[model samples]
Target: MNKVLLQWALFSFMFGLALSLPLAAIHYQKNSSFKGIFTNYRKLKSAHLDYFMQALSAAFVYLIGFAAHIEFAAYILIPFIFGVILNPTILLLEATPYIRSGWIRFIYRCLRATSPASLLFAWLAIAFLFLPTYMTIILLAVILISGIGILTFLIKRRSRNEVGVKITEIE
Candidate 1:
């Protein structure tokens, strides 16, 4: 079940990335006033970029969870996937011509205010409301620590590689 979910997440991410080309072309034709091939249609451009990034981020999270054999796959992965899909779906709707309508703009405004990170936090908030508070806090802390560790390791590795290259050039 987890494997299937991860596969679906990968597919969704690729689909989101694939969506950018056609949307870019449409933007170019419809909203371009900047003497370029793409639109200055800021909101629409933002929608496509945000959707693609959110899907990609969700896929990354799913991959990490799968690789680590995390026990809470359903809890974490499901919300990530659902939010990734829903956020972009809302943005895509906003990209349509009817955004001038007050209701649609309002919806867009609300969703746009919350990014992928905030969506994850919102899930955490919901979980905290329902589940044991300690469990939620521990889970969040683990994720935070893991993120920091990974980033630190990556930075050190990058610096090491750069030093190695410099040494080789000098010798």
Candidate 2:
């Protein structure tokens, strides 16, 4: 088992468990004052869920790598660790009122943009390490196609938005 991944998994799980305390407090308590502690309840909930998901993903990666006898390099594992930790943290920060503008907001936007790409690269790298060559090629092709499709959809949506064209108008 990779010690780094295992340690991060444990940390993420413990952090997630810790977050449940405040979540439960806000959930069960009827006091509006207490509920006001978090500005965005939805984002807080998303952060809580994401933490647990990241924990599980890290553990799964660790277990699979162990079973496959694949030793992951620092480059591969660094991105995975960074993404797992930062993704939920971004949501957690967004739930608060502190990061609204200025340099902090700029930094937050950069992190938000980077986290997904890091995780994608880490997962693809790990998959290539463990899976057979043919499967890796297939996986890469699927990912590329899916990315292109999503990009096309987003581009069309953006153009529609710029033209002030509503979905109802199109229909």
Candidate 3:
């Protein structure tokens, strides 16, 4: 009954459960010293919630599909595994001291560059399941804008480094 899919689904679920540790801390620390732990606590919480929900949903879908003898369950797992599991895992890792190391930062940058493509494709697949074509188009545009924004930020950061001038603040 597709044991491999079942195993991955369970793994996703466990990872979601693990995320609750940080989620609880974020919630409890919103007004305290630990509030500064995350640069954008609200956004982190939102992303964490998204990952938990999507992983939970994927687990259920996989379980149900296996029981029902459906062969298409793997397709449903792909997007959630990528967007929910992989993306948020990397974001969470950003909070670690080791992530600041050159190789780790490089990997993070590469992921930042490529993640939008994975997310866009995943969104496209999910949109086909539940969204109108027009809405899907709008989502695609949003994805494009987000990708452009990331690229712009990276280019600006690189250029700034190259110039040997640090602008404390720019508006």
Write down the worst ten-residue block by lDDT for model 3: 162-171
TM-score of 3: 0.50
* Candidate 3: residue 18 lDDT (0-100): 75
Q: Positional deviation of 77 in candidate 3, in angstroms? A: 5.4
- Pick the winner on lDDT between candidates 2 and 3: 2
**Clashing pairs for predicted structure model 1, backbone only:** none
lDDT for model 2, please: 0.86
Q: Which stretches of candidate 1 lie over 4 Å from their true place?
A: 27-40, 99-118, 122-171
Encode model 1's per-residue lDDT on 1-171: one tens digit a residue: 456555665665676777677666675666534324222345556766776677666566546546666534355656555677667666566556655668877776766665455567645754564557788789889989999999999999999999999999999
lDDT over C-alpha atoms for residue 48 of model 3: 65
Question: What would the per-residue lDDT of candidate 3 be over residues 1-171, giving only the tens digit for each residue?
Answer: 345545655666677677667667767766654446555555566556656665665566566556666555455456545654567656665654546778978877877766656755655665565567898789889989999999999999999786655454341
**Number of the predicted model whose TM-score against the real structure is largest:** 2
